[model samples]
Target: MKITSAQAWWVQIPIEADKQHVSDFGRLRTFDSAILRLETDDGLVGWGEGKNAAGSAGDYGTLVHLLNTEFGQRLIGRDPADVTYIWEDFYNGVRAGKARKAGHVMPDLARRGLTVAAISAIDIALWDILGKADGKPVWRLLGGAKSDRLRAYASGGWADKDNIGAQLQSYVDTGGFNGVKMRVGAMDGTPHRSAERVIAARNALGPDVELMVDAHGTYTVSDAKRFAYLVRDCDLAWFEEPVTGDDKIGMAEVRAASHMPISAGESEATRFDFRDLIVGRCVDILQPDPACCGGITEAMRIGTLASSFNLRLAPHLWAGAPCFFAGLHVCAASPASFMVEFSLGANPMIHNLSNDPVTVVDGMVAIPQTPGIGLDMNEAVIEKFAKKG
Candidate 1:
C-alpha cells in the first residue's frame, strides 16, 4: 500500500513534582514531545514519539512544522514498506553532502538533534505500519525473538545533591527496579561533588543493587577521569557519557583511565556516528536512543555494529512512551542488548500515555507480544497535553 499522510503533534506533558528537577542539560518540569502519526492508503495508522524538548522551547514547533511540511509532503504516495530506501532518501537526499557541505545543518529529518527526532518517530511509525500489515511484532520481524523478557534499570537520581540517597533508595526499595542510574555532573562543575553523590547513591543502594552514573556529556576528560577514580570504590555498573559525546578522543581517554565501563551514544543519531564511536574505542557500552538515532531500523544496525566490536548495546530512554517501547523491542530482538532504561520518576507521559504501558517487576520487564511495538497511544493523553500554538 502507499503512504497517504504523515503528521506531527506537539504536546507538553507536565511532570508530577512539587519542585522542579534539574538535569545536566536543563530543568525537567514538563516533558514536551513531538509525536508522529502516519497513515496508509488502506487507512492503517502507526504512531511514534520524539525526544523531550527541554531546553529549546521552540524545538517541538520546528519538529511539528518540518514533519507536516517538507518531510510529510515528500513521503506522500510513497511505499511505506521500503523502509531502507526511505531512510536513505532522507539521509543522502536531505543530509550528508548537502547539509555537511554547506555547514547549514539542513533540517534533515533523520540526522542528529531535533530534526532526527521527527524522522525517528516517523520511521518508527512506518515500521509499525509494516508490522501491523503483517501478523508479527516489530522485534519478531527484525529477526527472531532473542528473549521474551527484557531487564530495565531505573533511570533517576536527578538533582544529585538534593537528597539523592533517599531518592535512589526509594526507587529500588519501592519501585521494584533492578538497577538505578543517577545524574553526576549537574550539581557543580567539581568532581568532588559528583564523587560525594556517587558515594551517597552507593551507600543508599548497598553493594548488591546495580548502580549507574550519567554525566550527560557535562565533564571534561580530566574531570571525568577524576570522578571515575573517586567512584571506583562505589563499583558503578557503568559511567554514561562522562565527557561530551562529540569528544571521541576525550571519551576514549576517559574510558582508558576508568575501570568502570563507559556508556554513550544517546547523543548520536546515525550508524556512522556509532561507527566512529565503536571504531575509535571511545566507549565500552553503546547507549543509542531509538527516538534520536533514526528509529528502530538504525538502532538494529547500530546494535549489530556494536556486537561486531564485542560492545554491549543498552538502548537509552529519555523520550516518551512510544520511543521507550521502540527501544524495548530493539532490546528484545538483540541479545547483545544488556538493559533498557526506564524513567524511575513520575512521568505521566510514560505512565498515562499508553493503554498497556510496560511495567518493571523485580527489575525485569516482559516484551509485548502484540503486533507492531505492542502498545497503543492514549489519544486522550495526547489531546490533554497538546500545546496551544
Candidate 2:
C-alpha cells in the first residue's frame, strides 16, 4: 500500500510520586515516547515509536518534530511494503540511489542520533503496514516464529537495600518470573553500595529465580569490575551495560573480569554499533532497543550478529506498544533470543497507549498473532498524555 499521510506526537505520561523511581536518569517522573502514525492510500494504518532516552523519561519533542515535519512529509506516496529500501533510503539520505546501485551502505554523515531515531519510527511503521497488507503477524513476516511463547523477565527492581528484596519478590510473585533485573551503578553512587543492594535482592529471590543487574552504563570500568566481583556468587543471569558503550575496550575489560555474562546496547544505534560490541568480545548478550536501534530491520541484523557469534539476543523493550510489540516479534523469530524483557513499571506507553498491554503469565509471554504490531491506539491516553509543542 502507498503511504498517503504521516503524523507523530510526543507523549509524556506522568508517573505518580509513589511509583516514581530514582536512577542515573534521576527521578523518573514521566515515561516519554514519540509515536508515529502512518496512513496508507488503501485505508490501512500503522503505528511506530522512537525513543531517545534509554530510561523511562526524556524529551520526545524533537523526535516528534523531526517526524512531523521532514520525515513525515518525505513518507507521502512511498510504498509502505518496501520496508528495507525505505530504511536504506532514510539512512543514505542524498546518496540513496548511489547506495542502492553499489549494493552497500552509503550512509549520510548524520547516520546516528535523532536521524536514526526518526528512521526507526518510519521503519517500524512500514513493517507494520507490510504485515497488515500481507495478512500475517510480524514474526511470520520476519520468518515464522519458533515458539508460541517466550520466557519473560521482570525488568524493574529499584528499591533500597532494606526494601529491594520486597520489590524483587513482588515481581516474581506477580508474574512468577524466573528472572528479574535490578538497577545499580550511578544511582547507588558506589559499586559497593550497588553490590550490597544486589546481595539483598538475591537473598530474597534465592537461587531458583535468576537475578540480573543493570548499571545503565553508569559505572566506570573499575567499578563495574568491582560490582561484578562482589556479586560473583549471586548467580546473576547477566550484568547489563556494566560500563558505558562508549568504552568498548573498558567494557571488554569488565567482561574479562566478570564471572557472569555481560549485556549491553540499549543506547546503541544500528547493526554497526552491535558489530563492534560482538567483535570486541565486550558482551555475551546483545540488547538492542528497537526504538533507538534502527527499528526491526536493524534489530534483526543485530540478532543475526548475535547468533553468528554464539551470543544471545535479548532486545531492550522498555518502550511503548509499537516498539514493545516489535521487540516481541523479533524475540519470537530470532533463534538467538532466549528471553524478552517485561517492564514492571507504571509505563503508560506500554499499557494505556494501546487497547491491550502485553500480559505475562507464569513468566512467559505469547507471541502476538494479530497482523502488524497488534496495537490499536488508545486515543484517550494520547489525549491525556500528548504534549503540545
Candidate 3:
C-alpha cells in the first residue's frame, strides 16, 4: 500500500506531582510530545511520536511542519512495505538535500536535529503499518523476541523534589522496581550537593536495588569525574551522559577516570554517530532512544553495533506511547538489552493517551503481543491536548 497522507499534532499535557522536580534534562513540568499520524491508500493508519521536552524545549513546530509538508510529500506515492528504502530515502531527503535536486550533497551532520526526530516518527509509523499488514508484532517482524518480558528500571528520580529519598524508597516499596535512576549533575546546585543527593538515594534504597544516575550531558569532564569520585562508594549501576554527548573524548576520559560504566547515545541520532562513540570507547552501556535514533530501523543497527563491541544496550525511554512500544520491541528482540527506562511519575500522555501503557509488573514489562505495537491511540486525549490553530 502507498502512503496517502501524514499529519502531526502538538500536545501539551500538564504534569502533576506531590513535590518539585529538577531533572538533569530540566525541571519536571508539562509533557510536550509531538505525535505523527500516517495513513495509507488501503486505509491502514499508524501512530508515532517525537520527543519534545516540556516548556518548548524542542523545535516542535518545525517538526510538525516538516512531517505534514515535506515528509508527507516524499512518502505519498511510495510503497509502505519498503521500510528500509523509505527510511534511507527520507534520511537523504532531510540530510543530503537530495529532494531538491539530483546528486545534491550536504555535510554529514547537516540533518541532525528536529528534522531527524520528525523522520524517526514517520519511519516508526511506516513499520507499524507493515506489522499490522502482516498480522505480526514489530518484535516478531524484527527477527523474533529473545524474551517475553524485559526488566525495567523506574526512571525519573528528580533531585528538586523535597522528599527525594522517600520517592526512591516508594519506587521499590510500591512500584515493584528493582532498579531506579536519579538525576545528577548541574541542576542539583553543586558537585558536593549532587553527591549528597546521590548518597541519600543510595542510603534510602539500600544495597539490593540497582541505582543509576543520569547527568543529561550537564557536566564537563573534570566536573563529571569529581562527582563520580565523590559517589564512588555508591556503586552506581551506570553513569548516563556524564558529559556533552558529542564529546567522545571527554566521555572516554570521564569513563576512564571515574572507573565506572558510562552510558550514552540517547542524544545520538544515527549509526554513524554511534560508530565514533563505540570505537572511541566512550561508554560501557549505550542508551539509544528508538524515537530519535531513526526509529526501529536504525535503533536495531545501533543495538547490533553495541553487541559486537560487547557493550550493553539499555534504551533510554522518554517519549509517548508509540515511541515507548518501539523501544520495547527493540529491547525484546535484543539479547544485549538489559534494562528499559520506565517513568513512575505521572505523565498524562503516557497513561491517558493509550488504552495500554505497557504495564510494568515486578520490574518487568511484557512485550506487546498484539499486532503493530499492540496499543490503540486514545483519540480523546489527543483531542483534549491538541494545540489549536
Model 3 per-residue lDDT tens digits across residues 1-389 = 88888888888777776633555445556777788888989898888877634333554776777777777778787888888767777677545446435654343456777767877898789888888989899999989998888889998787443577888888887668999988888788677788888888888888999999988898889889999999999999999999998688999999889877999988988788888898998999888877788888888989999899998998877778888888989998886889889877666667778876557888888988888877688988888988876
What stretches of model 1 exceed 4 Å from their correct place?
A: 52-58, 94-111, 159-162
Write down the lDDT of every candidate, Cα atoms only. Answer: 0.81, 0.90, 0.81
**TM-score of each predicted structure versus truth:** 0.92, 0.98, 0.93
Model 2, range 1-389, lDDT digits (tens) per residue?
68999999888888889888877888888888998989999999898999898555567788898999899999999999888988999999999999999999999997899999998998888888889898899999999899999999999988999999999999999988999999998989898999999999989988899999999899998888888889888999999998888999999999998779999999999999999999999999999999989999999999999999999999999988989999999998899999999999777678888787578999999888999877777978887878875
Residues 1-389 of candidate 1: C-alpha lDDT, one tens digit per residue: 99888877887777757745766556667777788888999988888876634322335787788788888888899988988767766765646456656754344443467656767887888888888989689998998877888778888887555588888888887658768998888556699998888898788778998989988888989899989888789998999999887799999999888888999998888788999998888988888888888899889999999888899999987677878888888998886798888887556666778888568888788887888887788888888888777
Model 1 lDDT on a 0 to 1 scale: 0.81
Better of 1 and 2 by TM-score: 2
Give the residue spans of candidate 3 off by over 4 A. 17-20, 24-26, 52-56, 94-109, 159-162
Global CA lDDT of candidate 3, please?
0.81
Instruction: Report RMSD for candidate 1.
Output: 3.7
